[model samples]
Target chain A: MSEGFGLRSLHPSVLLLYYAGGITFGMLLFHPVLLLSGWAACLIVNGHLDGGREWRSWSLPMLGAFVALILVNPLISHRGRTVLYYMGDIPITLESVVYGATMASSLLGLLTLFVSYRILMTEHKFLFLFARFSPKAALLAMMAAGMVPRLRRRLKELMLVQKTRGIAVSEGTVTQRARNGARLVGALLSWSLEDALQTADSMQARGYGTGTRSSYPAFRFGPRDAWTAGGLFAAAGIAFTLWANGHGYLTIYPRLESFSLSKGDVGALAAYLVFLLMPLGWEWRDRTTWRSLNFGK
Target chain B: MNLLRRKINPKLLVIPIAIIYLVLAYVSLTRGNALLIGIVLVLLSMIPFVWRFERRQRQARELVLIAVMAAVATVSRIPFAALLPNFTPVTFIVILSGVVFGAEAGWMVGAVTGLVSNFFLGQGPWTPWQMFAWGMAGFTAGLFAHRNPSRRRRLPLLLFGAAWGYLYGWILNVTVALDVGVREQTWSSVLAVYSLGLPFETVHAAANVFFLVVFAPSWIKLLERYRRKYGALQRTDSGSADMEGSAHGQRTAAE
Candidate 1:
């Protein structure tokens, strides 16, 4: 799974399925808890699916950011009825704390999912998905996405060189730090100008932004893709229906509301569960098929 | 270094810069006021200055250096300012551009930094103001590229930079206040808002002084070294020597 599901190797259809599922889930659910839970599930699954090495590197920072969000958000936005305490003209409240936690969770979930997608989805997949719409735009998007990691690497190299030269920026006075930063910026600008020209030249040589364009063929809507997409659509439909009928949980500010579930809501939720489980099923089947092929070998 | 020495045709930079300017103009004209359009036009005008440098050298190395600087300048401003002191590294960045690549490069750095930084800050009518303020700061810095080095003379340049820093913030505040429909067009109202931004302005000015004091000598040394090692400084022809001598004499007196 680690090798096959790597971002560079993932099929475009698979990426599309993930995006469609996320958007549908986001739109269908309004309850803060459920929305947050959905977001967490996406993040954890995304992180785990990418494998342990990547997860290990990101987990600490992710946790730190989450804690920071929880601690900081409530302090700044102290607005609620249930006052927990008062500190120097500022009033803290239970509602505000909960709201802050929920917001943090939501953001964390989004970040997790985004990071997972970034690590799992490759430029090839992105280009493949959008190839038919606008080839030049798609190519540009691919280039932009690819540029992030490359730019990061370049900056790291520059920082190291600066450090070696005894121009330690982080340890300096505010003014000295600013000067050091300026020197780095000067170097970086000179670097990027050259890159942009090369990129433009390379792109132009290939007839980018021309009237017509060609693409490499890799994406195909197979049975697995069909099954995944169909399940997502069905789940989306049921979720939308539940949302429209006001059957699912709803919460307004300062008031918690949970509508009594009907037989229809139960059915819709059951369908959602099945839709969510479809990917797990695909993973199982693929594993089983591999085992079968290797039997007695 | 090789890239900095290579010659780039000025004409090539013209089309790309013009296209960007026209697009900015169109956006402002359609969605904003004349003030916004005027700001954008001023910012866009900096492109020609950048092109002037490119006309002499089309080296990939120089191009990369400029682009990376622009990106760093853009990224450095991303984090929320409530926690940090201020976002003033950009002024220093502009100065560095002038020191390393000359005036044209400095102007380009400012313009690109403004435009790119706006992407994360939320793009709208205010982008042009940010662009012009930073671009002007860089252009002003570049104007002093040939100034001789003396502590007394440097003091005024530093003060000039500091003043430019505050002036930029004041202009930005006015433009933004107008855009948001605050409608307090009086001097008092403008002062009230601009005064609030004093901390940020002070930080910017201080940053400029800091950057200039620390890096100016090093930059001058680097340029001298480059001229010595690679023989990059153009030899003054006999006819031009007299003109250069007078200019040199004036610079010496100024120092």
Candidate 2:
């Protein structure tokens, strides 16, 4: 869906493994370099996904969240010994601020990665992931995913109709407004419930849950998927090795430790970055090659 | 006290686990490792309890109903956000779902709403916590609602909704703060986070109270009617006999 990582084109199985591994790494690792690399990778993928339009909108909010964390963390946490000045009786320790910054970066990193996931993991992908495990739950998730957007659209229409009738949400006092909102919801509830009953009937008619349900397979494993998966595992293995060995590790508890890079640190960081950027790398290669072939004399 | 009942009230273990975790979280606020572990434990502790419901309700209709409730809860936030800005109808709908559908359905609705809505809000580390917080809200509300189904009163439901507002906020605050890291163990730091969140909590609680006060009766009646007419599964034996009467009751209400 993006110029960066058309991750959706990859087989859902590959995408799933990539995301599960990526998110796990993003969540577990707290190294500043790794976090920053992950965050930057997410932003770039997200930027490409939206064709460079919506990523800016997210940047400001993400920055705001990070800034808010920076301000709040030091105030609540006072563990570090280095006093960086005090606001009233509170000692805003250097370590806590640094820790907060790390957290903010990690948070930002995790959030952006999820944004990429939103782009990469469509409802079909989500359903595909769950379908093998529990067909009923998969069906439910699919219906629920479809229903959210449909219901939201319906609510907007209802609100518009209500507004035309002078019983709109904004036109009343606090209680009146809430009543108006609830009434709208109540109406939707009855309608949707009736609609759902029909669905249940239709599903029963189609013999749902009668036996092992067969799903329409929209994906197949191919050589490209296998190669990409291999690369992902190899990179991830190397990175995990470095991480487990304490390379590129920076501790912020008790006292702030040094973040100086050694040779092994650089290797670990590179391995980690490679693991994170595998999808982006594929997409970039594809785009550049396609562009050159088309424009070449 | 027999530790295990045939019909396990998950709240028995879940509630105590949460309280113990919260206490641990409070005590270890300054220690990053303990705080992190406490937060993860708090999020995970509710799973075994909620898992019981998932296994209990394996029927397609029940599954569809819970999904529908979750979808409705997710979408209901839009109008409220548009109109009230700070207020959300999500918790109200979630609580109502629990009250009408009983604990399992309520728990499912709550957890699913958190996940489905995060598709719009953008998922983060906070998602599991949201799922846990909302799931518990539905669990307890359903518990209360199940205990006294015949009396669908206003005050108690309203009070429960209001209480959940603050409780949800506190849980959410702790989750986010822990995610963000609260480096000191001091009560003041924890209090500061709570105080900063006071206005939002008040708004959330007020919104819950307001929604329940206004629409809970009608929604409950509507869902009850549907359950009766469609022969939706029930979680309690006490209400089993009332089904036939309510089926006709739904027909008349529709008419």
Candidate 3:
């Protein structure tokens, strides 16, 4: 509905395919080197999309999670043979430590990809894609999503008015605060339900359930999308086949293998990165076109 | 879209589901791909609920009732967002939705609460997991409420809420544990994930007990009145959100 650029201009299915493939490949490829490279590519793509502001906003929690995984894995699982140190009779293995770091990198890469995902896959695109597959459930999620802002405003109003009646959640003991919070929500619930049923009557008057619902125009599956989807599938197919043959995962247990990429791993890594960053080409193309049309680059 | 309107024979549905699980079983067993398998299973588990809801001929009031309940569940978190991390009336609201509207409506509310809340926040591996977990919490709440006669009873409802507080947390924690990419997962490694989540789950369980103690009676009464006045989700027990969930639950379990 709004003007979009680069990845946002892609069809919703293609966008969905990109994320699904990105996450799947990120999870499947377990080499720390590959994961680190994946993280770099992910961040660069994130920067290309929105200058990485969204990625920056989510950095703290993701970093905390990253560190937690790095610390927790070595402590809990004692499988790896290369024990780096001992903590109270618990042997900290270098293998588990490396495994944890790789996991953390995969996670960081996932969070970065999701930041781009949130930017490109706007709500309208999500609803449009899901609506075909599961109509009522899609409608349910969409309508509920639509109602959140209005309900939020009403809840704020209720909370403000209820503060005058010596009722507020912010300034109470544990039990007291919980009660006041639910009280505000209860009031909000009653108020919203009243208006909601009226809206339902309007929906009924418009013959909502009378026939199969016609939809608004969805984005066309253009030639650009076709080529992108074709390339994505081809690259991913190569990567997945190699991964299935055991090139993607690192050998962590029963003594760790060297992190050097074999020929198969290199091939898999190449295909995977191509699949991961193919959409970046769209951004370069879009930027050059925009610059030629509007201003000097 | 039209496919959902046509009656989907469960026996017919089983063929595709069985094939999917078979393929997934091969992948997970051979490749040790826990993360992808876990995510796929979570996504598949939600289909029956969505399928059940789609096939039913719903009244506008019922649809609106579910949308409003889900919105309320999503927004109910705002009041306490500053007070604690992961503390909110969302679970209670979802449970109440199940208790008042019946299990199917409760499940829809819970699942939609998961979907809508994450859409408002952001999507991650947890989106489908939250949907399944929250949906189960609400499903069980409705199942218990429906089987039992007394609607406003406190002790049973409080225990139910308390159990799901931890159960909900653990359901979400499973994804994280598997997502950690353990090559060969032993029992202790799984235990470590649970141990990591213990504090948050404890607070969550305590919060559920507190909310149930404080607001069950008044909130249930408030919604009960609306269900009667608007005649929303109050048709014969066969076709509405309430009774359909038990049947659906049995089918999902069987699968």
Highest TM-score scorer: 3
- Cα lDDT listed for each candidate: 0.53, 0.72, 0.80
TM-score of each predicted structure versus truth: 0.51, 0.84, 0.91
| Best candidate (score: lDDT) | 3
What is candidate 2's CA lDDT for residue B206?
92
By lDDT, the candidates rank as: 3, 2, 1
lDDT tens digits by residue: candidate 1, A1-297: 554532333356666666545544443443455555566556555544655455566568668867865675445544456778888888876655665565455445545555555555544565565544333323433443444446556666776888888664576665456556657654654465445656655645665445445666765545566666677777766765665565444442353234444665565555544544446555566567777889944
Give the worst 10-residue stretch by lDDT in candidate 3 chain A.
A1-10
**Root-mean-square deviation (CA) per prediction:** 12.8, 7.7, 4.9
Per-residue lDDT over A181-277 for candidate 3, one digit per residue giving the tens place of the 0 to 100 score: 8889888899999998889999999999999888886687777888899999999889988977878778877788988899999998899889878
TM-score of chain B of each: 0.59, 0.74, 0.81
Query: Model 1 interface RMSD, in angstroms?
Result: 12.5
| Candidate 1 residue lDDT tens string, B163-254 | 87787877676543342222222454445546656888887777667655665566546433432332222221111233556754553464
Q: Which ten residues in a row have the lowest lDDT in candidate 3 chain B?
A: B234-243
DockQ score for model 1: 0.08
Single-chain TM-score of chain A, each candidate: 0.71, 0.91, 0.97
Docking class of 1: incorrect
List candidate 1 segments past 4 Å from native: A1-10, A36-40, A47-53, A64-94, A130-174, A191-211, A257-276, B1-255
Runs in model 3 deviating more than 4 A are B1-29, B178-186, B235-255
